[model samples]
Target: MRIATYNVNGVNGRLPVLLRWLAETRPDIVCLQELKAPSEKFPAQAIADAGYEAIWHGQKSWNGVAILSRVGTPVETRRGLPDDPDPSQSRYLEAAVAGVLVGGLYLPNGNPRPGPKFDYKLAWFDAFIAHAAELLASGAPVILAGDYNVMPTELDVYKPERWTDDALFAPEVRARYASLRAQGWTDALRHLHPGETIYTFFDYFRNAYARNAGLRIDHLLLSPALAGRLTGAGVDREARGWDKTSDHAPTWIELSEQAPRTRSASGSRPSRAAKPA
Candidate 1:
């Protein structure tokens, strides 16, 4: 299946670009982040009209997440990270599409480090790492996808030196990401195109896309079992240039149809599987 993830920036402001990409790419499942709209403000009818079913978690003028599936109803599994004791932002949403358990997350963009926001960002990452560990323990074929707001490695970002002090590139943030990956999750793009210069975000102010100077903060990480079935992966750079588009572009991976049929060590198909952004 063609599973894709995108941080649309704002659902209403970029409706046309969103629809156009949906029509052109026709991904079987899509995980959207940063809707920047409230639940009531979500344009559900408009999305449905484009031939997909959606389930979303939204907040006013800020972080939000949603999953749109073409094959099955998107059953909401969770709304926010359970470990978040003071959960106030709508940054996470989980759903089941066809049998895949997809999660859409908009991790905090903790700019201007050494501040309260940066602390919050690290706390959120800790919570996510804990939650991911729980999901991995479920022994499911999981696909955690989203704009993690993290430059995983120097290769993942252009001019890494300039971002050394940035929250996303800080040593602690990278360590957390590494800890999560150590739990058996595979960075799908890196797994397929190790060392390749692929980027999913560009700065409009700097005309970054034209210069191909961008960051690979967006990702689609899957479990080892599912990684073996990854047929291909890519970033849709054209989406960045689309009129009224978000700074972030769409990233996707194609999985072989035969992948899911393989039995796990427990001798049954995984109950939770995902391909979310």
Candidate 2:
């Protein structure tokens, strides 16, 4: 199976680019973030016309998340982070596609840190950690894919020194990300291309894509059980140059059909959360 994630920026504004990418890539499952469209304006029929069944959590002109599957209707497991007591923002959605539990997220881009926005960003990460803990406890083969707005390490970002104060590169933010991964989810792409130079997002204003100066913020993190199935992983950098394209490109991974069943690092049996299609 081929699973991919892309931050479309806005579904309606980038519909053409999105459709074209879908036609060309044909991933079995696609997780989208930042739809920036209300649920009523999701253009479900248009997506259905492209041969994918989808479930979305949308908000007007802001954060949103959705999952589209070619093999089956995605079963929505959750909409927002469970422990977020006041999560008025729509930034997450979980679903099941072809037996794989997938989560799509649009983490806050808390720029100009050391302020309220930055605080919220950290709080959001905390909530995500709680949710991730629950998923890990469930023991299902889960994949958390999206634009996490985090640069895992210096190698994950271009000119790391220049982003010292950036929320994405902050030590606290990186530590929180590490804590999430420490829960037993393998960073699929990094696992395949360990310490390799891979960039997934670029600054449109600075011609960053053309210069190959980008950050590996978009990711596919698989549970330890599902990691063995990963066959190939890549960033579709070309997609970032399409007309009205998003700053983040589509990142994807392919898995073999006959891979070994995934199990916890400790050899514990797996379990799953209930989902609704």
Candidate 3:
């Protein structure tokens, strides 16, 4: 099965680009973030027409998340992180699609560090971590996919020195991200291309895409139960170059029907993907 994640920025404004990419790639499941629309204006019919059944949590003019599946209708699991610090914000959405529990999230963009927003970001991360532990304990095949709004390491940033003070790259945020990964969730893309300078998001301005100045913030983390089935992963960099596209591209992982007896570290390969753009 192929699963992908993309931060749409604004579902309504980016519908055309979203549909085009969906049609071209046709992933079995997709996790979308930053819908920036309300529950009533999600354009469900439009998405349905594109051959996907979706479940979404939306808020007005801000954060939102959704899971779309073409293989089967996603069975609703959770709407938001258990005890979300800011339940008012539509950030996390979880569902079961194609036999995998998919968790989609739009983590808070804790900008302007040393403020309530940043504090809330950490609190939310803690809540997510606690809930994730429960999920891991369940021993089910789970894939946590979305825009994490964090650069786990210096390697994930194009110019690490330039973003030291930024909330997304702040030491505290990175530490939390590392701790989450340490809990046994596999960072699928990094597992396939460990040393590659891969990025999933680029700033919309400053000609970031043209210069390949990007960050690998969006991710698809596989639970231990499904990690061995990972066979391929990559970022659809070309999608970012499309007309009026999102700054975030589609990041994906392909999983085999069953786990192998022994998975090789160098066995997985990336699918068709463009150079950083």
Task: Say which candidate scores most in TM-score.
Answer: 3
TM-score of every model versus the real structure: 0.92, 0.92, 0.97
- For model 3, how does the per-residue alpha-carbon lDDT over 109-221 read when each residue is reduced to its tens digit? 89889899999999999999898889999999999999999999888999899998899999999999999998999999988887888899989989999899999999989
Q: Using TM-score as the measure, name the better of candidate 1 and candidate 3.
A: 3
lDDT of 1 at 244: 81
Every candidate's CA RMSD? 5.7, 6.9, 1.1
Winning candidate number (lDDT): 3
Q: Give lDDT for model 1.
A: 0.84
TM match of model 3 to true structure: 0.97
Q: Rate the local accuracy (lDDT) of all candidates.
A: 0.84, 0.85, 0.91
**Candidate 2 residues 1-277, lDDT tens each?**
9899999989999999999999997989999999999899998999999999999999988998999999998999899998774567889999988989999998888787999888888999999989998888988888999989999999998899999999999999999999999989888777766656888888987778888888889988888667877777777777887878998889888777756565222331112100111
- Candidate 3 deviant stretches above 4 angstroms: 273-277
Candidate 1 residue pairs that clash: 100-273, 101-273, 145-277, 146-277
The local distance difference test score of model 3 is 0.91
Residue-wise lDDT of candidate 1 within 131-224, one digit each (tens)?
Answer: 9888888977678999999988999988899998899899988998999899999888777667578889989877788888888999898876
Better of 1 and 3 by lDDT: 3
**Ten-residue stretch with the least lDDT total in model 2:** 268-277
